[model samples]
Target: MNETVNQPTYKRQRFLLSFVHQINGSVSVTDLQKLVFLHMMSEDSNYYEFIPCKYGPYSFQLKEDLDILQRGGFVTLDYVQGSERIKATGDFPTGYFFRIPTERGKALMRRAYREYPYYSINSEITDRFFQGEELEQFNRGKQTYAQTEQVLFTIGYEGKSIEAFINTLIQNNVRLLCDVRKNPISRKFGFSKGKLKHIAQTVGIRYVHIPDLGIDSDKRRSLATLDDYKHLFEDYEKTLPSKKRFLDEILMLLQQNTRIALMCFELESNMCHRHVIRDYLVRTNQVRSVDI
Candidate 1:
């Protein structure tokens, strides 16, 4: 119950370092499980949350890690909340919390490094599976979390011109825009598929429209049996075969090129299939999403 009073033991430190190192940067809990699995193979402690920590578990969740990092002045969480369907939903904004080691944290790492010399080990291990940008991604993940303030913006086509939106997307260096609307066409003037695609291409953004990913209106209505959107999401997850297909295609696209944004009608991802897509990506692949 009282974590700080115990201080971090050497066993805890070693396990933590190994867990953090395995993550390599930002990670979701599912990916964290895989990393833990690799580190604690054939060990009963591997499922510590379901079992015991002494044997292995090293179970880490983003919120818990974030809390520890925040206490250490290492990382801060930032998110935007948007109102949709009379409810407020949270979404990730521009970059996530800046992840860096604090001075004290760095001192701890240095001492650990002196003892284990994992950097050299990692250099060799990384050389086997990565190069260039991939290597950078792998290395950047090793830093301890750091907190920083984040700015949140609301989504609206309102007073802004579509050209301006396109320009803003370009400025963000968005590489691929995966349109997840069941129907990519916008009845509203200037938001139609032809115009959006033309504009996106003209600005050097690759656009691929996937319609099957949209929320089924009938299904949503039927599922109105549930009051909470989270429950709706759970039902959607259970019934939607297309969502799984969408994820498979997205993963294939990732293998082709990692940069991509899941686009949908609701500009805020939390209210759309994009949120599900984003969650699946981060949970399964450790990919980051930034709302544009």
Candidate 2:
């Protein structure tokens, strides 16, 4: 006869494998961290203690558990590059991390689900979390902004193809594309102001360049650390109050188009100045912004 595993050990393994399985057997480690954090928050489970880290919530215990699982042959780790082919790019732009489950992992998760159906509650929570609080607020805000109005959307084009970028805008029903760059030129082929505008027109979206709302290239070029970005954005924020004219213009555009997306080059919003602009608009105009 096979030895029975302890309940606590089984539970932890089940939860981890089930979570990975629920996301189609493959998830970025960063995304898995966030999903688990959200799961803990929603279920009030004390499975892990998460602290606010550089990339949202993180848990050392969770990391350790994943390591143990990998060592035991429960899962496999793979590193992938982003779909973009930009040469001489750093890890942030060029590298992608993923966790994939082994056959053993899938079998364990299936057994756990079959034995304890209650664990399936996490699937619902995962779906809702992906919908995002900002998206929820945007849906609510539409009633007040205008019948046809939608929330402001922000996106980064650092590691995406032009097709992917354009599809994202269309999927979100964006009516305007606001280029929040001090200089609207990029070595990335389709992102330069002229090329970007032409593509947006082809898809029936209006494009505008808002250089005044952008951070200077000099300030952005040397951002090797998070502190550097923080300091740069802090200084950027100080200048915003004086740019009332530009802010008002943005508001006017929003009022007319209703669904506008701010475009930048950073993959993550927190690492970019576009988030600063979004927060400022939300703070002053009582409007919601969503990153798409």
Candidate 3:
């Protein structure tokens, strides 16, 4: 039985929709955690505990939850070779894949948005998502300031193609790449601070490594307790003011002409501290994240 069945209908809807969106292709567990959290935040700004998945103790029952979504026909899971090579043959090798709802999912979401109008999250001006000229101005001018505008926003990273993902930001001419990894050196590509810095520089993007944005393992341990995990999570929430200060110090370095992206190992923002930082920026600086 799907334990998520007992969760409020909106919570389930938010989780499944975000999960399906992230799994449109291959995705790592870390990526899923981030995506789910972002969705929850968009639905409700105060919502910050993670979905019940393997990333953390509270979200450890991933198999069961995924099973529920699978049974509902909301998603399909398969293990493939993990990569694909395309050619004129038109036949591709088998690889890991998570087939997610396309048009049908969007249609359902539209209906849900109507039926559960109260389920919609209304973030304060500081929590609004960024779009259009606001984003353009932020990236184009140095130190140019805009009053904070509250707009609904969500962070999503896991998707079909990595090159496609990178291209989105490049096409937008995003200028700065903020490396929020504590170590800045990873065993993987696109994460190690050095490699990412070089790549972003080559693409005309400035890369800045901010150790403060890295998840504090000690702090995380403090957040996990036997008694439901909510207490510790809330404790972490209280520290945001300091975190915001640190992030602002970093942002202050931007010369009004910079567009910044906080990068970490997790593909989704929710699973990582970057989302919290993103929230702080939106609420405090009027800066918002767009899907790029």
The candidate that achieves the highest lDDT relative to the unseen native structure: 2
Per-residue CA lDDT of model 1 for 1-292, tens digit only, reads 2334333233433344334433334443333433344334334442222111111122333224435633543332333243111111122122222232222222432332333232222232443445587556645643321112221111334334464455455444455667766666766434567766765665456777777766666655554332556676676666545467767887776556455556655555565556766666667766655676
Ranking of all candidate structures by their TM-score, best first: 2, 1, 3
lDDT, candidate 2, at 35: 64
User: Which residues of candidate 3, in runs, are more than 4 Å off?
Assistant: 1-165, 218-233, 253-255
Q: Residues 11-80, candidate 2: write the lDDT tens digits.
A: 5655675565455535667666666765665567766655323233455557766766565545566675
Of the pair 2 and 3, which is ahead by TM-score? Answer: 2
Q: What's each prediction's TM-score? A: 0.42, 0.50, 0.40
Model 1 regions lying over 4 Å from their true place: 1-160, 220-228, 240-242
Best by TM-score: 2
lDDT of 2: 0.65
Q: Give the alpha carbon lDDT tens digit for every residue of 129-185 in model 3.
A: 334765344234322222233222322334322233344445455556666666777
Order of candidates by lDDT, top first? 2, 1, 3
Steric collisions counted per model: 10, 0, 19
Query: Who is ahead in lDDT, 1 or 2?
Result: 2
